[model samples]
Target: MFETLPNARRCAVLIAASLAAMGGAAPAFGQAAGQTAMPDSKAGAAKPKLWDARPASPNATINLVHLLVKQGVLTEDQAAGLIKQADDEAYIARQAAKAASTRADEAAKAANAAAAASEPKGTRHVTYVPEIVKRQLREDIKREVMAKAEQENWASPGKYPEWAQRIRFYGDIRGRYQGSFFPTGNDQFDALHFNAVNTGSPYDMASPYNLPTYNTTQNRNQIKLRARLGMEADLTSGFNAGIRIATGESNSPVSTNQTMGGGGSNFSKFGLWLDRGYLTYQAWDRNLVASVGRFDNPFWSPTDLVWHRDLGFDGFAVQGRYAVSDSFTPFGVLGAFPIFNTDFNAGTNLAQLDSKFASRDKWVFGGQVGFSSRFDSYRELRLAAAFYDFENVQGQASQPCYVQSSSDICNTDQTRPLFAQKGNTYMLLRNLQVGSWNNFGTTSLYQYYGLLQQFRPMTVSASLDLGDFHPYHIVLDGEFVWNTAFNRGLAAAGTGLPASVGITSPGVALNNRAASSDGKTVGPFNGGDKGWMARVTVGKKEIRQLGDWSVHAGYKYLESDATVDAFVDSDFGLGGTNLKGYFLGGSYGLSPNVWASLRWLSANNIGGVPYAVDVVLVDLNAKF
Candidate 1:
């Protein structure tokens, strides 16, 4: 129908048809559908109105105009102008939407910041992680890293043994310069046997009643070295094994320092001693441990007042600790250590009736029960009471004779077998008045008496620590010991006699029975049986580098028989009991694992004999 209509009428039909195709309704043109004629606006005498000139629909009109251009009815410039106008509007809409989104993001961020700033301290703003979950996370991360490392072969494939992972090794070395000074030593009890003749004499000097050679001025200096290597291993069934090797002689139990420039040379190779080798079984959630074999000293001592740090024990010990609360723990230690081993000769000799002349070996049975309480992380206190009873520590024999002598005669008062004395007061059990004459020919033969007392020491020690007072710690510790046997020996010194001459065995008797020459029984009560020590330390807990320091000072008064003389400090008063002294020391760290220390000891005999000994030591220590 549009093809048969006039030009103006056909154009109107095309515009309506295009608008209908584009999904828009065309406005009524006021022409009936039955009537074929249509008003022609472009050919009217008056110019068309603005509304009549405008297209019926913008989209359809644009499409119709494109069709007109393609059909050569309109020029290309007219079509290009309409397309540019549509592009500009679409670009403007995209810019406006982008600006709106940016504004929304800024407002959200500002609100979040304001809320965070207004939140108070201790507010539960974050999801909390419990200790258990944190621990689990740590374990998981470790396992995952380990698994990845294994899969990727990051570790050595076969260079090291698998058991190496369970082993830990540690060691330390110390180089020391020591000096000893003695001035005007007057009439001190000579325990070092300086007066006795050994090389020029015809016999070994095994006696204790010998008089002092003569005290004079003595000064000495030497360099010493102490090195130790230790290794510990984890074992099956909650057991662990450890071993330590140190530079010292095997027989010296109280010292591990090896003197330098010995053996008539400037430099001599030192020897290594087996300091410790032990196996420990852990039970009761690792609070209790039972150890056997040669091990470190099990006694708890804050200082070397009662027990030396180098002293090792060959025995078994059981240590246990119970935590009653977070800050209070009670602990106990029980141990049995061998002191001396006696040997019984076979019955090959006809002079002796039987081989079993003596009884058993000497032993030490001891234990300590203690309480450790921590008021907080900054303060602590420990108090322990201990009892040590020695069995067969004192020798038991009436007569000590030498086989080299032609007749059955007691050895000289200066050359008899007795306990090794290192300055402790040892009362002569046997009457040596017969051998008072220097000439051996004038002496009368008599049976000798052995040691007459057993050691049973009761000790109480305590320590307090006030941690981190600024940069230093305040540590105070003290010890008190009462040797029950000391008074027994003193009582025997002036007493008369006992019913019998104790038990007749070598290092096998515990009962102490002393009889004087007149043969009268006496009671057992005397004095001189106490010892005490006190120390104060103010210093850093540990030295990590330069400018770190610690200082300590201590005073100790040891009675004649408070503790074994052999086990006392080897450097104080030249090592032994019956000595009272003051020691001052300071340490400075050179590096994290290296340090230097200086200690000075000024000691005098407890008997007030005007004997003064001063010792100074400077040491450089390194640890790994």
Candidate 2:
């Protein structure tokens, strides 16, 4: 029966047989193989037969034969014969498909040739990119690569580490030529070297010629240098840290200038002191800042009448500012600074016994509240009121003690100030027994002196900037301070009369304690408690570029005890209080981050004595 069928039917039967061998089944085949079938009514409503559902393809014919064999309608011998004929039909179909594919490819080639012939001769379609466009593309690619390199920190391997990106470095250097002119008739012997005496062993009053005194009538000239280097780092979580080192002759809080060849003069190297070391935290988006360790002054002052510019406070400070509007900002600062700390073993006797002294730690607790206003884009004003209270800074007199030997220590000797810069009234710190000086060969006592008046100053400062002329504006700044803790009686009795002659006076002591016709004393012993300063500056506020310039003139009147002498400006009158002076200075930019300045300061004793001095300074400064 298979030999009688056509080749197409044979090929279809072979495909069906293969499908049946691979486990294909149909409902019709199942029924034919004696499986349960659907009823006639359901079969009439059913979908088309499985063979009719397939497309009219070779597989359809194969499926018909596969069902016959699966349902036992055809034998295995017949299915084998159908498969042989199907293989032959498949070979012929493949040959026809190859010939048709070749003809289609030739047609595509002929169409492309016709299209090319229609174009003009020697004409071609080419994208001509401009050089600028090419350059832009290259730059864009380079920028992307660089950005990735920076983010991954491999732009230049080992050249700069990852952490270095968060740090900034800055520094400045200054060289100055200064001349100090001292006029004739200035008192030479009365200006005691208080700092030197207090810091070392007490001076023996029996040897009057051996006492320490300041240079009063000496005119001198010297060169000086000041250099400072600092670094700041951005730490995690809104914290910042900074450190600075500066050159100075000594660890003086008011000045960082190193006098050329001053200490032993053999071309010695200058010493570097820790100028600032601080850590700060910005809380609430920089609305409040808190700092610890030695840091810059937290308060705002118009002048250096109370605090020197180079002074660093050792303690903690908090600063807060709020912008009520675009034109007005109110700010406040509170700080606690440790001026001096008592040693752990404050007093040690000659017998190797430790009798600890009470803690005489000195501190300054200060606060300032102020507001800044901008009336216009070119005009502004600032006003501040502040109070600084010095704690445990006043000296106390010691109990009477018998000095049997040079090694005998006074009980309250530690009350003496560790450092001083004159102008304040002083009294003897130690009271010796009546016969204790027999071994010293004189009745005069060997003792140290301490400041008589305390310092708790109230200061008000103001600044007015009239920048209506833009860069060539004028600025007016002024400050007034009054010491609330000063006592007239104590200051007068401490250094005024002959009856209270044991007190040590600054400047010209004899002239201050002038004897009257009736043997009474009259002088400026009523130490003043008020100080004020005013200055006006014209032109640019800062020297930022070449040809920029600024000039300023100022007058200062600081009386004794108005403020701590050790903390005021160190350049005027060479330093200290009880002096009135006028200064003029101007600076011109030499280049970016570099400038030259000249200043003249003429100062004279406000009272007590006629000591006068004039200073001239020329400086060259650079910053990086």
Candidate 3:
């Protein structure tokens, strides 16, 4: 049993044997062995020694059990039993410590399982990540969110309807300050108001004091506005439609300006007219187009010599173009436009109930052919020739008419022009017979005038663009017009001279070459029949971006019968033909879609009474 004992127990046994041989007293290990033995004198008896009742350490218990055997306090058999009991208690303590360690490991594993179960599905458990990877992930998330929001219109979901995607809207507005400076030596009375005389009651030829005339002497200043709104819709299959409305003082084909304080002031609402409404169809690979409605001019005119810029043709027009090569293109246009339509109930006289006038519907047939030649990418030239023929637009003399009272109607009253401006030769329409009423206080023949000569104008236009400086160009334009149907002999015969009832001067003739007041002997009618215009520009074609600019200068000379006075440029000579002028203008872009312009025009009458006008215009324009 001793050989099988551990080394620590063997050392304890050797130490106890050595202590007994030396006859040394046992050292007290703790309070259990510190008490000294005592004797009882009265009883003459020895008391038992006290011992600690707690469990002892393994080494201490072995030492204490050996000491008891040496001191005769316990027998050998009992000492051996105490030694075995100490060993057994130490073994039980070792088992308890191993059980506690096992329980702690199990508890840690259970906690780990619970944490994993509580996490969301598909979640990655990353304890550490790089800074660059984190940043890249954030950027990717942001881009994805923005793309989704845009696709779904998240800010205002479903706000835009499907049909709105196929429509496009456009408009522009302009405000102008204009000053008309008339020279001091203008003949105010000579410029007759032909429109007022023809539309209203006939002017009294006997009394010329109350005749309507133009304001040629008075200098006027006014503010004007022009606004247009338009939209285009795609009908698919190379078909499209458009409509536009604009501000106007009246329904005039040559202008859309509305005077700021006109039309019965007091903050009254101005009028809006249909400026354009058209439906067009394109075929043959978009080279052929046909339009039927009030639409823009189909002819490629270099300048507004024969047609006003704001005029729209109400009829059918077909335009065709063929691109022969990269450097050349040929185009042509053919259109027929109605000038005026006689009323269904022509005659309005109660005296002659069944006197209906003949149908005198006026029309114009025009054709143009043009070609564009591109010298290079930055240089081009365009040339065009056109012919416009007027049908049923001339006046005829009426047969002998008896106008004893105001209720009598002339047979050829409808022959007079529906509208006319200055600078056109005119002749009296009524041929009155001798009557007793003419000798009375009031004249019997109340008369109106009609255009003397017929009109069939031939025009040639050309434009050359030099674009050596990119985004800017130097443009040269020229146009010439000649009235082919002007006949001086016929014009002289149409004006009834001495046979007319009212003995009067030549009524509103374009030229002063006429001789007699009562139109007796026909004089040489030196009426002008040709007109030409030339212009030069150095600027961008359009003012779009900020800081863009352009400047232009031009000269115009239009004859009395070169083109219709009512359809010529309205700005020069205050809206008429038979005028020569020079104009200088410049425009600057203030911001995107906004611009400002200034122009000065100095014009004089080509023939007839002395008339001159200088106009200055300042304009602010905006578009969207």
Could you tell me which 10 consecutive residues in candidate 1 have the lowest summed lDDT? 503-512
Better of 1 and 2 by lDDT: 2
Judging by TM-score against the true structure, name the best candidate.
2
lDDT, each prediction: 0.65, 0.78, 0.78
The TM-score ranking, best first, is 2, 3, 1
lDDT of 1 by residue, 1-624 (tens): 556764434455665676578654444565333232233454344453333344434443354545444333335675566556555655786899979977975786787668778988666555355697699899999999888767655575764445676789999999999998887734444323421321123222233245334332568888888999999999978999999999974347778888777644556577888888999999999999999999988888887767877788889999999999999999999999977664454123456555234444678899999999999888999999999988765533334443333223322232222334344433332232233342442333223333335578899999999995847899999999988765443334433334232211222221122222353343232224688999998988787678789999999998666776667678888776667889999999998889999999998766423457899999999999
The TM-score, computed over Cα atoms with residue i paired to residue i, of candidate 3 is 0.71
Q: Is candidate 1 or candidate 3 better by TM-score?
A: 3
TM-score of each: 0.64, 0.73, 0.71
lDDT of 1 at 511: 19
Write one digit per residue (lDDT tens) for candidate 3, span 1-624. 997776445545654565578664544334353242332363234333333233444565565665455454455687676668667867887899979976975776687677779988886654344587689789999999878766655645655544565678999999999999998988776677777878778777667667788889998999999999999887889998999999999888888999998997877899999999999999999899999899998888979999987789989999999999999999999999988888888875566756778888889899999999999999999999999998877777677776766556687778788777667777777776655768743576577777877899999999999999979999999999999998767544523334332233323242423344645434445458899999999988899989999999999998888877878888888888878989999999999999999999999987666789999999999999
RMSD of each: 19.9, 18.7, 22.4
lDDT of 2 at 105: 60
